[model samples]
Target: MAIATPQQDTPPSELAIEARGLVKRFDATLAVDGVDLTVRRGSITGILGPNGAGKTTTLRMLLGIIDPDEGTRRVLGHENPRDVARLIGYLPEERGLYPAMKAVEAIAFMGALRGLPLAEGRKRGRALLEDHGLGEAADRQIRHLSKGMAQIVQLLGTLVHDPQLVILDEPFSGLDAINQGKLEVLIRGLADRGVTVIFSTHVIAHAERLCESIAIIAGGRVPFAGRVDEARDRIPAQVRLETSAHDGPWRAALPDTARQVGQFWFFPLPETGVEPLLRALIDGEAGIQSLSIERAGLHDAFVAIAGEAAAARLVTSDAGEEG
Candidate 1:
């Protein structure tokens, strides 16, 4: 409930997390392969991947919840992540709350696990509920609260200890559109207050909207990691042109990669530029009805980096999920 103001004294280049060559295996199945990641202090980073892409395993390794079979990691300057556990908060994909526990009690319980005093945790829990418009539900049992309310309570619990770094796994899994938006605002607010955040999600849109940087993983291997803009730059911009004339001399100006669909023509923007193409269209009387250029989105970049098959799997997996 007490959010820290953005710190002017913190260095811009400080690293919050650094991991390299992380590997984890479960029985004969390799859950994570040699992976490297870096997170800047006070930044929101997303581990973007489809279902079964080793996202959870990777997060667990970084959090010291599960030891890596190989590689090294440092969290908030400590070589052993667990050494700084008290400074970190984690919300696992699996949600758990005692049905009989009051909302405030549930939050206080979580904070107590991280070493907060019971009374202090209770005070903060009630304040958090009141701050987030759930003050009326503070005294209600968890079982009596709606699913969305319970989730918000758990999220507040994650922050009750005022952790410097927060790691969330599929935090948006079961929320509806409005709740999802609220979560996005909450995450942004955390980053604004200088709390480092790293979250994993199969959905690309959330990562695109919330993360300045992201790591794209598929089949336990990272295909890309860096700024979201860098990932989008992997592919060229696309051009969509609609013409009144189906056949004309301007057709010669179109790239060989262009494809026709109904009244629309689509292709990657030419290397030279759109000016030459526009001139050709106008001079040759191609009767251009409409033209637009669009940069590749994170979704298109995902398809480019992870391949169409993996992208298809991501779409199918997301479709089956309630959120």
Candidate 2:
């Protein structure tokens, strides 16, 4: 077998971030192995995976926090991200803020590191604080602020230099529901303003609610990518129905895409036929009460793919423990 080589004429750059066969090894273990990612311009791209699923490792290698052993990756049109640091906003899973420094000071310091002018950095910091509802805490020391506030500051510092792409790693961790909602809104607002936002999270709802597109990664590889609906479409559209009687004439009148799960009826339609289904149910006196098609969401897809990998990992871990 012959391996394909890169063509002499490479294609023009159109992606915000492009990675091919990315591999990163920590000692003997491969944290990330042969992952490909393409984040489009002016869109929110989500990296979805379970814990230790190599999402963070992939992010780090792409951002130049670490280098891949044998792969190609480009961030904001640069193969070497370090040179493009000023044009990228990176909110790492771990906070990079100075615990003893004031909120505004820490934010300004990060901006300065990105080579922004001191006055400009300070001005950006102030705007960020005001925008994220942290205006009052701008003067307070980072050590004195709550975790959520500090997180907001970290995010602010990332965006202070007005980077073209924002990479947020687990940005919603340890936050209350309200804070998560605010963060999701902020992320969507960034995408709306034409910033290519790439973020990773264990929280499925955040990814589902905020991102227009997503990549589902597990065991150091992407099982799915592209539009969220495209990925969801890979799984059948399952509409669940609850009826009064265990048996009904509606069963015979079921849509071509219908199936049964115990007493519940599931319809996997190309499109919704809720009205017809409901009418049939009512005619048959099946006492149908509820219908839902939103079940075939990212969560269901993630589970369908990654859940097996996770279960296998658990079984291996248990075997090792016994051994």
Candidate 3:
């Protein structure tokens, strides 16, 4: 199989995927409300939201698997997704593989379905298996492989065509830490090769680490869409202090943003250094146990944008699934 080539003829537009006021309805329930998203060519972007937050629906619409009731979309520079279907690769959240099929055979079959000849597909599949550290398992049946192996095989099948754009839905749902890390590396490799990647994940950490930009959807609507740094900037820095003196004159030195959290007092650090506060606390004879400043992360940004309840729900759900 020929290596999937980077898009040689660049689209006049810089975007790989763009949607305007995309809306999808399931019966009377609006799965995706009016949402706008744009993924730049060769950039890795993430669609982040909790379960049932319309991420899957939005992806489907963008891929033309499902049409939106309202709005418009263009994929890979084509007005219609089918026009460039061969240029796109998709890995759905639901995992499936032919249990009786050999790993190499399975991957090759997928490539063949996407227009690659069986012989070439098989050749490429073998090489890919070796590259992915599954060379010994190439001839083994899918049913004999571990869940992680099967998952990687399925994902590789999605990549067989060497698509210009890869859209993955909850790609990290069931993988353990090691396999998850491997997948992250694979995603970055794709981006390094100039492939546009749009992945939807409930896990924000994956997006934080892998994406250049993100579209944050909540309640079926996108509340934020921009670079990761922009999102992080939406929330202020945090300061955590553990002090033996919980009250008195030391309290006066504390910023108005300060709040007690068990034995620690948490607050948003002002733009100025904490030196003044430290001096004030010491002058007031306050016994400081520990003090640390933390830069705001995606999780903190998400909470600030989507509210604590929604963020907490996603964290709880992710923990349960991982456990």
Local accuracy by lDDT, each model: 0.88, 0.77, 0.85
Write model 3 residue lDDT over 106-214, tens digit each, in one string: 9999888778888888899999999999999999999999998999999999998788999999988888877888999999999999999999988877888899999
Question: What TM-score does candidate 2 get on C-alpha atoms?
Answer: 0.83
TM-score versus the correct structure, for each prediction: 0.93, 0.83, 0.88
Residue pairs clashing in model 3 are: 1-120
Candidate 3: regions farther than 4 A off: 1-12, 242-250, 271-290, 316-320
Model 2 whole-model lDDT (C-alpha atoms): 0.77
Steric collisions counted per model:
0, 0, 1
Q: Rank the candidates by lDDT, best first.
A: 1, 3, 2
Give the distance in Å from residue 202's predicted Cα in candidate 2 to where it truly belongs. 0.8
- lDDT per residue as tens, model 2, 162-275: 888899998887776667778878888888899999998766767777787887777777766677877666678667787777776867657776777877777674354567
Q: Give candidate 1's whole-model lDDT.
A: 0.88
* Deviation of model 3 at 180, angstroms: 1.2
With a 3 Å backbone cut-off (N, CA, C), the pairs that clash in candidate 2 are none
Top lDDT hit: 1
**Model 1 per-residue lDDT tens digits across residues 130-190:** 9889999999999998888899999999999999999999999898777787899999999
- How high a TM-score does candidate 1 get? 0.93
lDDT of 1 at 114: 93
Off by over 4 Å in 1: 1-13, 316-323
